[model samples]
Target: MEHKDNRYTISGTDIEEVKRKNGQSGMSYNEAIEWMAKTTGGRGTAIYSDTNMEEVKKQNQSVQDYNKNKA
Candidate 1:
């Protein structure tokens, strides 16, 4: 997990590992929150608020822009 500003980014490998650990059933919402707290030193992402939403939007837009240019 990488923490910069208010964003928390977890890799697909990490998510797969979590799923594997949880018997492939996947984690519940609370389980994911606990994992984030433990893994990120208590700096869990605020799902209740708009934390990092802008960054996520910007990233998505960037990808769309890149694909448009490539095409």
Candidate 2:
């Protein structure tokens, strides 16, 4: 999902709620984005690909692995 700047206007409370409900610190960026898209309804053409998502997932996994090893 390619998010346009100023395209979605979700409230802080709503964002917090989503985070709280979706796993808080464990929530991935893509998960939060998915929630926002669902909450706000979809519009405009998708100008992005899943490649960005794959990168995010990779980074997230890296962090998770680092934390696990640290612990």
Q: Candidate 2 — what's its lDDT?
A: 0.60
TM-score of each: 0.32, 0.31
Leading candidate by TM-score: 1
The lDDT for every candidate, in the order shown, is: 0.66, 0.60
| Cα lDDT tens digits for candidate 2, 30-67 | 76566656566445313322336678899999999999
Off by over 4 Å in 2: 1-51
What TM-score number comes out for model 1? 0.32
